[model samples]
Target: MTLPIDPTALAGLVSRQIRTGERQGMPTKIAIAERTYATDPDDLWNALTDAGRIPRWFLPISGDLSVGGRYQLEGNAGGVVEECEPPKRFAVTWEMGPMISWLEVRLDPAAEGTTLELVHEAPVDPDMWKQFGPGAVGVGWDLGLMGLGLHLDSGAAVDPATALEFPTSPEGMMFVRTAATGWADAAIADGDDPALARPAAEATLAFYTVIPEEGTQS
Candidate 1:
């Protein structure tokens, strides 16, 4: 279904940035992006931390959330909460089966409201990185941020089925295109060759917005 959202205004609500850094003994890189929300740090923190509120915007999350605890997202990754600093920052291990990644989030109070920055680091799989660049993970975060914005604005639970089906929808493709282009810009800013990164952005966009074949799920 097509959502009633302004592609232009929606595009203006957030920004994307990317940077790469090394890790110990692994061929890996990290991507960090920040999105500013028109809300206080405490409110944004609550939205991110409160289990009751999480499923409204992001996914239905369970398990312990304190430092040294484990948390799981319904139908998604579950990991150890490595650090927690209330309304400012949190760090966790994002694990799905044998694959492992690290995710960190920081909130900074700003004139516009609160700036939420997410850092996701994963061991680079040469082939996958070549296929999608930063947008592989960047675009996923973009969708989560969009859902957070919607929930913050309306305080309504998003329909999961609808959210899943969105990317293949017409207006949804427009939003996806905007997100993909933003990531291309970010990659270029990080010194990636545009010849490679731009096409990776397109690959990422196509991956996110393409229709699934009959009887197969996205």
Candidate 2:
């Protein structure tokens, strides 16, 4: 199926930021992304948290799905459900292999539709952040949000294989480039050097869109 995505409109809908708050003993940076969905809060929340319906747009999810429960998104992060309140908000501990982070999603009614806010907080890893900036996580969410939009707009399931191949497609590359640039803008807004942020954004774009040479793999 053709990926029905509006890159320009989707780019306009996203807002990003790098927020700092104390986590353990020092300051931690959280990558925050927000966008509005035309659907209502109830519908949006169902699309997000309902395991049965998730694989249609996003990944297949298997989980206990309640406060203090555990969840796994196929081939993605698995985490503990830290908090949950239907149609409003949910918080979880994002655990991937040995790394841990915190994730919170909030939903609210908006003038045009519903506002969805996602916060991914992790202890500052200066080395990685310096090399990639927020685009690393921001672009991933951009894809997920775009998937949600397409699913809601068309009321159809996105073939999982197509979703996996999207980034390598021309339109998908354009979408990711726009998203990575948007993240760079957000980082600049938060006082990161434009010189640094722009390059980091480009690095992120390369990571997501470029195919490695066939002979490079050992």
Candidate 3:
């Protein structure tokens, strides 16, 4: 089944910025492209917190979702929920590490729909982040948001793996290519040398095999 939203538009919706590390010897900071969806805050909140709803777009997530509650995403890492305020904000530990990469999501009610904001914060590890990059996680979230939008609008059920495969399809490949370019732009904006950003972004896309073009971007 095809989705109503344009994959290219969804790929381009991300807005990102990078922050220099505060502490001496600390790694640089990484953030994702923030996206806002047109929907209701209450509906958005349910999409994020309800286990039954999560797997439709995102992974199979199992978590208490309450403040200080620990949670896990099947086949992925586990962490604790640091903050949870209904229909407003939710934050959680993303993976196992002292660095404590975290994800924060916020929802604001609007006349047209709910505006959703997502922030992923973590220390920079050139090698690691390059392997995953924003698209790795960002694409996943993009699929999740799409699924949520459909679920709220039409009672549709999306399989996480199938949604993820969207990027590998012909249309999905276009989205992935554009998203890679967008991330490269973000890397450049963050003060990364073009030399570094170019290679990293190419490598990242290659790692995910999302782009179906003849030659690798790198």
Tens digits of per-residue lDDT, candidate 1, 79-186, equal 999999999999999999999999999999999999999989898887887789888888888788888887887778777888888788887788888888888888
Q: Each candidate's lDDT (Cα)?
A: 0.85, 0.86, 0.67
Each model's TM-score, in the order given? 0.93, 0.93, 0.81
Off by over 4 Å in 2: 212-218
Error (Å) of candidate 3 at residue 194 is 1.6
Error of 2 at 90 (Å): 0.3
TM-score ranking, best first = 2, 1, 3
Give candidate 1's TM-score: 0.93
**lDDT string, candidate 2, 1-218, tens digits:** 57856666666678888876778886677888898888899999999998988888999899799898899999899999988999999999988899888999999999989999999888777888899998988899988988887787787888887888788787778888999999888888878899999999999988888866788941
What lDDT, from 0 to 1, does candidate 3 have? 0.67
For residue 170, what is the lDDT in candidate 1? 80
Provide the lowest-lDDT 10-residue window in model 3.
Answer: 16-25
> What C-alpha lDDT, on a 0 to 100 scale, does residue 198 get in candidate 2?
97
Candidate 3 residues lying further than 4 Å off, grouped into runs, are: 23-25, 96-99, 129-134, 210-218
**How many residue pairs clash in model 3?**
3
Clash list (residue pairs), candidate 2 = none
